[model samples]
Target chain A: MTESWLRLAPGFFALGALAAWELAVRGFGVPVYILPGPIAIVAAFLTDPGGLGGSLLATLTVTLTALVTSAVLGAALAMAMAASRLARAAILPWAVVLQVTPIVAIAPLVIIWVGDPFASLVVCATIVAFFPVFANTATGLAAGAPEYFDLFRLYGASHRDTLLLLRVPVALPYFLAGLRISGGLALVGAVVAEFVTGSGGFASGLAYRILESGYRLEVARMFAALVLLSLAGIVINLALGAFGAAVLRARDGP
Target chain B: MLDIVSVERRFARGVVALEDVTLRLEEGNFLALLGPSGCGKSTLLRLIAGLDRPDGGRLTWDRGRAPAAGEIGFVFQDATLLPWASAADNVFLPLRLRHVSRAEAMPAVHDALARVGLAGFESARPRELSGGMRMRVSIARALVTRPLLLLMDEPFAALDEFTRHGLQADLVALWREIGCTIVFVTHSIYEAAFVAQRVVLMTPRPGRIFREIVSTLTPGPDLRLDPGYATLVTSISKTMAAVLAPA
Candidate 1:
């Protein structure tokens, strides 16, 4: 019985916090422009559900595309690095520069160069999401036991055979860990890129909606869009977590 | 059957691992490389298995050509199984690397597992097994390829005495059944004496063979209980102590 209640505790706490915010906003008679109450945000959400939903769908598409592209590219580059010391030495510094430099600083140039709003946003997000997968997979590919390497040599396994049979299995947990971090970064990248491009006059996705609502003094609508954005991040993290857990459990056995 | 001809291995800073080491192995003979830690027994084993190249000298096999990949088997001090894979999958690794399908390799895999006394454990993972059972899986994987020579580097040093004794007997039985040449490296004088027909004693710090003893015990119910076994162990210990003492 206590366990069941404990499971519901987070939900209850969230409801209580929401009720307190609503009561405080109404009790203090704060202007909606300054701070909209929960009721007002819900009312704003009901006003334009289609618009909010459309923006959310747009953001999600960019996020997923960026994540998938980074995952493939990052893993391939890591494999190349594993194969050769020269490639690692040549490529790592540039990858580090791209990662450390701000996406905001890069987004404008990307939009100008790419000349396609959606594609530029994706490129920006891909920059944000690529490093974790590459760095983690590189570490994992080298983490196999020395004994296993000798065993492979004794068997006369080719480079491809050793990679597929030994290194890949050994590096799986590390790859999944990188994937989880990159999932969250992908979302952050998409929204930040959208914000930069939104000001450049591409009026698509939730970040644009947030900026437009703020200028128009539609504070409740701004809060509604913000809430959807937060919810999207939460859902993405939880989904990635579930997927990683399932993969590791399968590998670890019954 | 292999020959280690004047093999010399030197590490960085000129630290010698093996010095002027030469030995001849006959077909179907079980040889024990008996030595203390850092005596380069493992290094010698690696050279024999073609995992390491000697700085000087060569390994000449009976076949004129060098052993092909998967032609020689090895078991380490630790049972190194792929923790995520099933026992069957681990055993099938050698064959699978050759592009044999699981269905095609299942018979050899099963036969190897059964030979190791781990029959019906095909689906168990490494973590799910006991220490001895995991070692059994390692042995099964090594034997699945039917290698001509088996090189073991203290393969049972980590197990308990009870498990060690049991596996030792099983190993001898398997050796007799397969009739392959085995070079077993161990620090334990008694293990070397019990398991091998010929014991090659080595000295540490620039490892070189100091003594060689050959004595064969007939397989029978009373082999371990025979009075000669204890005498053999005692005499080998004396020889090892003399090597450690000053001239």
Candidate 2:
């Protein structure tokens, strides 16, 4: 019973905060154009569900696509680097360089060069999220216990078998940790890129809606879009955290 | 059968570990390499196990043929159980590595654990078991493969006297039942006397066999605390003291 109550505490706290914010804004008679109340944001959200929903869908699709691409490509690169000392020496510095270079600076350049807004945003997000997975996996692979290798040698295990059975299993927790970190990074990268490049033809994401509301001086709607983006990021982080925890628990067993 | 013909091993940086070691063991015999610290007794066991090669001389088998792969099982001073695996899973490691499925090796694994008096502790993790139990799990793992030769390097040296004695008696029974060759390395005079059919006493560093004492007991549980056990222990202790005396 106590554990269940503890789990629900965060939801209750969020509700209280929202109630307080709405009361304070209404009591102060704050204008909708300045600091909108929670009720006004909700009203704006419900007023045009189709427009908000479309933008939310667009942002979700771009972020998830970039996240999946980064995970697969980054993990493969990490494996290749771990497999070859020469490749690690050559490629790891470039991966670091990509990580440190801000996506905001690169987004406009990518948009101009790639000639496609959506593709540019995805490339930017992939760049942002790739390094954590690569670095963590490399460390995990290299950190396999010495005794396990000795056991492999004693049993005459092949190189492939050693990697598959021992090294990969050992590296899994670290890789999942990296994936959790990258989940939020991918969302941030997508929104930041969209903000810099301006969402293009056929679709606009939450960032573009936020930008459009700001230009039109619809501050309540802008606040609503911002809230949606923040919620999406929080949800992604919490969901991935739960996923990584589940994986670790399963490996540990009952 | 295994033969060590003048095997001499020297490490890098001028450390001589073994010098001119020659010994021969018949099939299914129990031999203990007995010595104090830094005597390379463990090194000799490693050579026989083929974990390390001799620097100077060759080790050979009787039929002039190499032993089959997985023909030797080794138990280190540490239990060396994989921390992530359950006790039964750890025991099944050797079979799993050989491409034997868990279902096929399950009965043999159970029997080996039973032989070590760990019949129903299969699901327990190593961390959950006591010291004696963990060592039994290691012994069971070593025996599960049914290797032609068992190489144990001070396997029970870390255990308390009561646990060690219990294991020594259990080991004698297991060896008699399994009928496999064993080369055990230990620094304890009492342990060597208690367990081995023949104890090969060694000199200090750059170890060579100083004496070989053959026991009179038949391979059974009655070997311990026999009347002759004291005399044999005294003679081996004297031999070790003389070997340890200043050059």
Candidate 3:
């Protein structure tokens, strides 16, 4: 029973906080405009979920696109860095520079240059997500046990063979870890890009819905959109967590 | 047969790892290079495996040709199996590198694992096995290629005594059955005596051979308790101690 209590602790705490919030709003007669209660937010969501759902889908598509792009590009760049010193010295610094520069600051320029709202958001998000994967994978590739390399060389394994068989497996856990972090960063970048672009269209995401709700003083609806955005972030993280666990478990061989 | 005539190796940092190290290895003989750490025993093994080249001296084979890439199999001090691969995949690595398809190599891989007593462990990962079992997988990997020469660098140094002795016996049996020349490097005196037909004692710092003793007692399960085995271990230990003594 104690073990079960410990396992259920987090869920209970979240429920308690929501109940307290709902009671506090109702007990104090807090106006919906100042701070919407949990019940009011649910009422707002039930009023017109079609709009909120569309926004959620739009943001989700951008987030997935950015994440997949960063993963592929980051892994390829890391492999290049591992394979050649010249490539590492030449390109890795630029990647670091992109990582250090604030994505919000880059968002405007990316939007203007790409001229397509969706593509620009993807570019911005990819920049945000790329560094963790690249840096982690490079460290992993370089850290391969020296003795394993000697064994590969003894077998006369080609450079390609060593990279694919030896280094790739060694880098897998690190890469998966980076993927989980990148998944969250990709979502953050997508939202930030959406806010900066301010592209008023039928395909506008949750960021635009939040902005539009704030302007109209629809605090309850704004909270509903905010809740959905939080849910989206949680879903992305959980999905990536599942993926990383599955891949890293391969080390255990079934 | 392989000949190492006066091989000399010195690192660029001016550490003389070997000086005039000369030895001849007869095919199918089990030999141990026994010495303290930093005695260039591993360096010499690397030279034989062609993983490193000597700054001096020549190596010639009986076939009058340099040993081809696939002609040598090396086991490091660690099992060194790919953590993500199954025991069978790890054993099949050398043949895979030679471009043999997995289906074509599965039979030989299974046979190698069976020889190492890992018959039912074809799909097990390195982490799933105990230390002794992992070392057995390493041995199976080394034997899979059927190399003419097998070089092991303290492969059992990390295991407990019981596991070490068990592996030592297995190695001897494998050697007799497989008929490959083995040059095992170890710092253990009894291990050298128990496993090798000839134990070569090496001195520290710019390691050179101090002596080579040939064991007359036949290797068997009873050899560890036999008086002859104890005699050989004592004699080898005394020689090793003298070399390890401060000048």
Candidate 4:
């Protein structure tokens, strides 16, 4: 009983906090436009579940595509940098430039250049997500113990073998860490890009729904959309964390 | 079966690590390079192992040319293991690099671990083993390929006395069983005297071979109490102090 209670502590606290929030909103006679209660938000959510769900799915699809693309590109770039000093010197500056440059500023140019709205949004989100993977993986690749290198050299291991077997396995945890960070950032970037690229022709994202609800003074609907996005971010983080821990446990010791 | 003819290794900024060091590696013998820190004992071993090149002289092999790095085994001061891999996989590394699959390399891997007294700890990780056990795993990895030449660089320096003693005895037995040439490097006089048939004392800094002693005392459990063993240890202690003492 105590174990289950401990496990559900966060949920109980959330419910308590929501009850308090709902009471305060009702007691103060606050307008729905100003601060919607939990009940009002749920009612708003039920009124248009299909439309809101579609928008959430669209945003999720864009975020996931960007995340996967960033993972592959980031890993490839990091490996190249680890392999050659020349490549590291040349590519690292550009990657940093891309990472530091605000995606908001670049989104307009990306949308205009790419022509397709979904592809442009993906490009913007990928730009925001790939940096951590590159930086962490690069550090990990260079962080091999010097003694291990000597051991490899003593065995006359080919450079390819050293990189693939020794260096890549060493970098796995670091890459996973980067991927975890990228997961949240990918969602943020997708939402931000959708907010910027609000054309009506393409299927709308949750960000567009939030924008539309805000203009129409449907604050309850906007809050409902936010709940879905927050839940998505939480799921992504928990899933990645569990996966990384499992892999490390299996490879390393208990 | 190997000859290092006046080999000299100089690092950057005119630091002569080894100068005019010549040694012949007698096959199937346990040899120790006994010296103080920075005495280039390790440098000499590296030159012999072809991990480093001699600046002054060349090394010639009995097989007409130097053996390939893959054909020799080396052990470091610490058990340099892949923490992510199991003990068996760690032993399987050199063979893995040679493209031997785990299934194909299983017999050799199992034999190597068993020879080191680690029979059922094949799936155990490095962190799961004790320091001495980790070193045993290291030795197992080195011998898995059954290389003719094994170069060890202060492999047991970090172990406790009891653990060190146990490993020292096992190493001698392993050396005899395998019948391979070993150049064991250590700063411990007792260790050098205990494990090796031949001990070469080296000077500090610009390392040079100061003296060499050949002992016929057979190493076993009672070898530590042998008067001849105490005499050998005492004989080297004076030089060891000289190398370590202030000039």
Candidate 5:
């Protein structure tokens, strides 16, 4: 019962915060144009369900594609880097540079150069998501005990067999951890790129809706879009977290 | 048969681990390399196992023939069982690496596990077993390959006394049954005397064999607590002490 109460505490706190927010806005007679209450935002969400739904679908497509590309390419790069010391030394610096450079600063330039806002946003998101997976996986590949390596050598295991049978399995947990962190970063990168690029018909997303509502002074609609974006980020984080935990549990066994 | 004449090993950092180490082993004989820490006993075993090359001198097998791949099985200090594999899979690893199918190797795997008294634990993962049981799995894996020579580097040093004693007996029984050449390494004089037919004691740092004592104790399950066992242990310990003493 105590454990159950502990689990519900966070939900109760969030409910209390929402109630306080609604009461504060109503009691102060705050202007709805500036900041809409939860009820008004919910009404706006209901009224323009189709438009909001379309934008969400667009954003999700871009984010998921970017995330998948980042994971696959990052894992490949990590494997390549682990296989060759020279490759690691040469490519690691550029990966760091891409990771540290703000997506906001490069989104407009990417859009201008690529001539396609959708592709540019995906590239930006992928850039944001690639580093953690690469770095974490590299570290994990190098993390196995020395005795294990000696055993592999004693068995006359080929380099490919060692990598596939031992190194990759050991590195999976680290890669998943990196993916969990990267999932949220990928979403943020896509939205930030969309905001900067100013989505048109072919590249419209939730960020474009947010920018549209702001310009038209529709506070409730802006809140609705913001809520949707936040929810997307939460879902991505939760999904990746569950995936990582599941892999660990399965490997650990019953 | 294996022969070593004046073998010497020097690390890149100029620390000599082994110097002028000469030894010869007959086929089907059990030998133990006994020494203090940092005495290069492991380096010596590695040299024989072809894991390391001597900086000076020669090592040769009888008839100038090298053993085939997987002919020498090694058990390290730790069990070193692959954490992800079941005990049966781990035992079958050597055969599998040699491209033997699981079906072809299953009987040998079962016999090896049975020899190590782990018959019912074929499907148990390494993590599910205790430390001693894991070591048994490692032994089973080594023995399953049916190697001509078994090299063990203090395989039981980490286990408690009861488990270590039990494994020592199991190992002797297995050796007798298989009639394979065995070279065991250990820092424990008592363990060396208890398990090996001949114990080779070495001096500290830049290790060279200081004494070779052959035991007359018959190979049996209950030879450890025999009255002669204590005398053998004392003789080996005294030799070890003399070797480790000041020059």
Candidate 6:
């Protein structure tokens, strides 16, 4: 069907590019180490998926753990900021500082301080993911319609009730928007942290696999590891997007 | 009975919103505070509802004790329904805030929605409803608590004439049925004359009562076409024009 073909257009382009790359490498007599073709990368993936699979899973676990931690901690901080002006004033500047500081710059110090490579990577990733959620949720909490505040106050609603009923619901859309941004950032942070830690030959996440393959002149295996990392990032973003859409539908009802 | 004794309100920016306003509201009386824009009509209502404090005068309810915010039902100019909530959930808000379970509040919620003629639309969100329907939901939320004093600020000013008329009739019927004191605020002369037993006309800057018009005809569909209602409307309109005209 045309509709189905149109939907698969991106896939066709990807396949076409791979075919062209394979032809170019073979046609040009390029060496396998410097410029491996798509076929060689696929062969590498098929040959040792067991080892590659373990590394992919490890990277994915750290990425997901960091994302969840960021969301929970960020939402709590946002709520606290909404509840008290003093807290907002005291905490907001530090959050901004964390956001502006490059994760790569801090990764070395974090690795040294934490000692455990996994914890260090998670802390680095969480630092990267926290800002978007915190800023968006804080803005959303304060963005409640003025009429709603008056209505709640007229009803003698307690502060707890106002926060729970009015502020939280108002903050949902903004928080979800932030979550989508945080999802991709979390993955990027994980890979960057892993790359920094892998330089010391410590762990077995996908970044380390890529590093090891590069060092051993296994260009095909490195590309395969890179492919897995890209796939993980795409999956994280899509899953977060789907979850946000579901929550919005639920809020609006049928 | 509610008494407002020389109420004075001044905003922080040195703008006088209300000045030495004094009025008394009897139990079960349907009164309309009719005025032009920026005339402190809403300011006075806020004072009565205890949403804002008057700088000078005192407001005393029955037995010289002011009613708590929970005891007064206030409706804003806009519908102000939580867009995220269903009509039933919106109506259940006050009761829920008082720690009433949803199951326990269901009957009262249903009753309030029914009173506003929104019986079957309980599951609909505010965005799903028409403007009139949304306003009805707002009224339902205000009425769910069954407060003895109802304060409405231009509640139907945004609706079409047909919907406004329909709501006005329904409001009169509900008022008669519930016997709650309603202090309705509006700029519409017809609306004031149509629904209220007494219309308190107000002047513009630092608003104070300019004139009081009492309708002798009872509120009903026939009252709209009645010669008496026309005369009352004309008199109130003339008074408003005179008061609002720049000297």
Per-model CA lDDT versus the true structure? 0.90, 0.86, 0.90, 0.91, 0.88, 0.90
Clash pairs (backbone) in predicted model 6: none
TM-score of candidate 4 to 2 decimals: 0.93
lDDT of 1 by residue, A1-254 (tens): 99999999999999999999999999999999999999999999999999999999998999999999989998999888888899999889988998899999988999999998889888988999999988888888888999999888777788998888888888888888998899889999999999998867457789999998999999999999999999999998899889988988987776
Off by over 4 Å in 6: A1-5, A26-34
Off by over 4 Å in 1: A248-254, B101-103, B219-224, B245-247
lDDT of 6 by residue, B92-200 (tens): 9989888899999999999999999998998998999999999899888888888989999999999999999999999999898999999999999999999999999
lDDT of 2: 0.86
Task: For residues B1-247, write the lDDT of model 2, one tens digit per residue.
Answer: 8778888989988888899998998898899999888888988887786678899888889878766656788888888886667899989988888899999999999998999999999998888888899999998988888888888999999999999988999999899888999999999998899889999998867788888999886655666658788888999988878868776
Clashes, model 2: 0
Candidate 2 stretches greater than 4 Å from native: A1-34, A81-91, A112-115, A200-203, A248-254, B3-26, B33-47, B53-57, B77-92, B100-114, B118-137, B157-164, B186-190, B198-247
Off by over 4 Å in 4: A1-8, A200-203, A249-254, B13-15, B101-104
List model 4 lDDT by residue over B1-247, tens digit each.
Answer: 8888888889999899999988888888889999889899988888887777888987888889887755789999999999888999999999998889989999999999999999999999998899999999999999999998999999999999999999999999899888899999999999999999999999877899988989889878678989999999988897667656877
Q: Could you tell me the lDDT of residue B104 within candidate 4?
A: 98
For candidate 6, the chain B TM-score comes to 0.97
* Candidate 2 per-residue C-alpha lDDT over A165-226 given as tens digits, one digit per residue, 9 for 90 to 100: 77777888889989888888888888888888774622488889998999899999998898
Query: i-RMS, every candidate?
Result: 1.1, 1.9, 1.3, 1.6, 1.6, 1.3
Please write out the lDDT profile of model 5 over residues A35-119, one tens digit for every residue. Answer: 7899999999999999998999999988998899999999998998888899899888999999899888887788878877678
Candidate 3 on B1-247: residue-level lDDT in tens? 9899999999888989999989999988999999888889999999999889999998988999878777898999899988888899999999999999999999999999999999999989888999999999998998888889999999999999999989999899889888899999999898999999999999877788889999898987678999999899889988777767775
The lDDT, on a scale of 0 to 1, for candidate 4 is 0.91
Tens-place lDDT per residue, model 1, B142-180, is 999998888899999999988988888899899999999
lDDT of 6: 0.90
Of 2 and 5, the candidate ahead on lDDT is 5
DockQ winner between 3 and 5, please give it: 3
Candidate that beats the other on lDDT, 4 or 6, i.e. the better one:
4
Cα TM-score of candidate 1: 0.93
lDDT of 3 by residue, A108-135 (tens): 8888788777899899889888888878
